[model samples]
Structure formats: C-alpha cells, structure tokens
Target: MAVIITNRSLADGIYMMEVAWEGVVSPGQFFMVRAWETDPLLSRPISVHDYQDGVVTFLYQVVGKGTAILSGMEPKNTIQLEGPYGNGFPAVDTPLVAVGGGIGIAPLYYACRKFKEDNPKKKLRVYLGFSNEAYRVEAFDAIADEVVVDVGGIIVGQVDVKRGETFITCGPRVMMDALCQVVPEKNPVYVSLEARMACGMGACLGCSIKTAEGNKKVCKDGPVFPREVLEG
Candidate 1:
C-alpha cells in the first residue's frame, strides 16, 4: 500500500521519518520502503522503529544504491511498503536497557519505546555506541533516562546492573561480542544482526545466523534473537 511521506530527515547520511500509512503495524516490524515508480533494486528493507495509529516511523540509514534512492524522495510521494516483517524483539518487563551501534540503533529505537509503553514505572536506559564519536546519534537523551557512551574506538562498553532486567542489541559482530560478554544471564536480551537479505522472506537464505536451535535466517528467525541462542 502507499504510505504518505509525512516527514523525513537526514540522520547524518541516513533518513529518519514520520510516515502515515493505513493499517496497524506491529511494534517491532519492518516494511520494504521505496518509491514504486522508481524501483532501483527490487526493494530496500527498513524496519518500523515506532508507530502511533496510522503514522509509522522508520529510522533508516541512506547507504548503498537502494537507500540513497530513498533519501532523495519527497513528501506526499507514494512509497511502497510490504511488511511488518521478521520476528521483532520480545516484549519485556523489569527495567529496560537497550544498546545499539551505528545504524543498528534502528530496531532498538522501537524496542525501547515498546518497553516504556508496556511498563510505565520501569526505568529505561539506552547506550548508543557508534563506529566513532562522529557517527554517534545525538538524540539518545530524548528517549532514554540515561545515555551512556557517544565516542569512538570501542562501541560496546561494560554494562553493570542486576541480572533481571531486559536488554536488546543490534550492530556489528565485535560490538555484539563485547555486549554478550557483559549482559547479565537469563535477562531477556535480544540481538539484531546486520546480514544480507536477498529476500525478506526465508526463501533466499541471504541473511542466516546459526542459533542454538538450528541454522536460522536472520530475515526469518530474527534480526532479533534471544541472547542465549547466540554463539557469542
């Protein structure tokens, strides 16, 4: 269906939005967004970072040919959106702690919002680690009670807290590795990995990550997996 481009912004080089589309979108799902008339490379997948009524917001990085084409679009323009795809982060209880590195912050954005909506009394803390201090997103303070690091070098810093809070992660390998080491055990932490997806559906097998259960497609089984399922 056509999602009206109500608003758009350049998040460094990435594009963020406030789009109004018909229908209900799941809290942690994504839609394949692109100007249909100007189809460049099939479809570019972007996740629904947050939503309120018909207005669904996606925070996407305008990287590569597909995303670059999306960034140039204008308001009132019709963009094709296919989903609410893959498995989103599991909803949680207890205090919420979310961490993302670089553009991986996209899913974490929605996850945190969902957490707060479900549990109003719980405290929310976010740590957005970027490739460098320059690439670090500047808006963490708005959503999180605490914004941890905004620097270069190591994207994942040590996380210290009780063993019962919920955690979510999305970013690079080294960064996730660092986080996996630190997050408390059995705390309901989920990780979103950046892998190639030829088809958002499971047929193509482009984005697969091994889990404790079996070989799972990131496009199918995840983008978000329980921390215990990850190999570390």
Candidate 2:
C-alpha cells in the first residue's frame, strides 16, 4: 500500500496525487490505484506523472466515481496500489519529439525527464495541446529543450516531423489518430493507449484492442505500442 502525500487540483477537475512509493518505475508505466474499499470494486490505471525522491506522482482527471473519490483523498491516507505496470517508452539516442493532448501530457513529462537525464545534449521537443487553457505548462517547460502549446488549433500540424525523428505521444484516440497520420512513414512513433480495465494483470480480458498484428492487451501487451502496428 502506498500512502498519499498530497492530492491537489491542478486544473478544473484534474488532480495531482503524490504518493510514497519505493521501487523504480519508468515513465509510461502506471499503477492501479484505489482509494475506496469495495465500493468501486476495481482500481483505476493512472500514468506516472513524475517519480523522484521515493515519491511517485500521478496526474488524474476526476471524470468518474473512482476518480472523484481519489480527488477527495487527503494526505497520509493509504491507498491500494498494484504496480508500475506496462511497457514504458524506449530510451532513444535520437532527438525526441513528444506530443500530448490534455491529460495525455502526464507520461510525456516523465519521459522527457528520463531523456534529458540520459542525453542532456540531445534535443527534446515537447508539444502539448489543450481544448482550452493548459495545465502544467511550467512543468513541461522545466525538462524540455523546447516547448510548444496549442490552445484551440490542431497541434499536430505544428509538428515538423524531421526525417528519422522519434515521437512519443499519448492523447484522446482522435488526437492520436490525427497525429499518426501526420507523422512520416519512416519516422518511428510510440503511443500510450488508454482503455477501460477490470484487472491490471492479464487474467481478465478487459483491456484488449484490435491491431494489425492481432488483438493486443493494453494491460499486458502494452499501454505503449508502435505507431506502425497500431495504424496498420
């Protein structure tokens, strides 16, 4: 069990929850968090916003009953946590272009931190899009070499997509689909997907999505997948 350190609202319904954790967790990995006991039987998968100093942070939007409960949780309250599950973004030596929409920016923030730690000289460009005002802009700006924000327009169109560039992104399906269409065929792109999940483990066939390869489990196979296989 992880103890909640802080749970504060960052935006309208979006909350940032910091918990005391001990283990190494990668950027795109997530934890199945539950603040209630039996009321909302299953836990919610929340992406790692940042992890440092034995504290792991998660950015969540309070859209449902489970999240609403999480939002109301106070400091020192212990919550059930399952894992730092799912495959994270690959460590790339090539320049990285991270594009995120709304809450999708959660994972990218940590990914950028890892990239900068691995290769400080390499370029790390971050592009974040929001339907209205942006949250955590200062946070992204701290780790990224360059930061771009789009409030009302298509942020995908602003991406230059240099040849052989690597992109790591996550967002609403429509936004991801649009960005995938814009990315060059030769360029490599990785995306973190979201789905309704009953169990964080693979036992339940809950988080499955059809891809060109076959039906893939988001909870096991990946919350992160290559763009080619997903788009194909």
Model 2 has an lDDT value of: 0.90
The per-prediction CA RMSD against the true structure, in angstroms, equals 2.4, 0.9
Off by over 4 Å in 1: 36-39, 132-139
Each candidate: what lDDT? 0.72, 0.90
Which lDDT value does model 1 have at 95?
88
Candidate 1 accuracy as TM-score: 0.88
Clashing pairs in 2: none
The 10 consecutive residues of candidate 2 with the worst lDDT sum are 156-165
Off by over 4 Å in 2: none
Model 1 deviation from the true structure expressed as Cα RMSD, one decimal place = 2.4
Local error of candidate 1 at residue 60 (angstroms): 1.3
Best by TM-score: 2
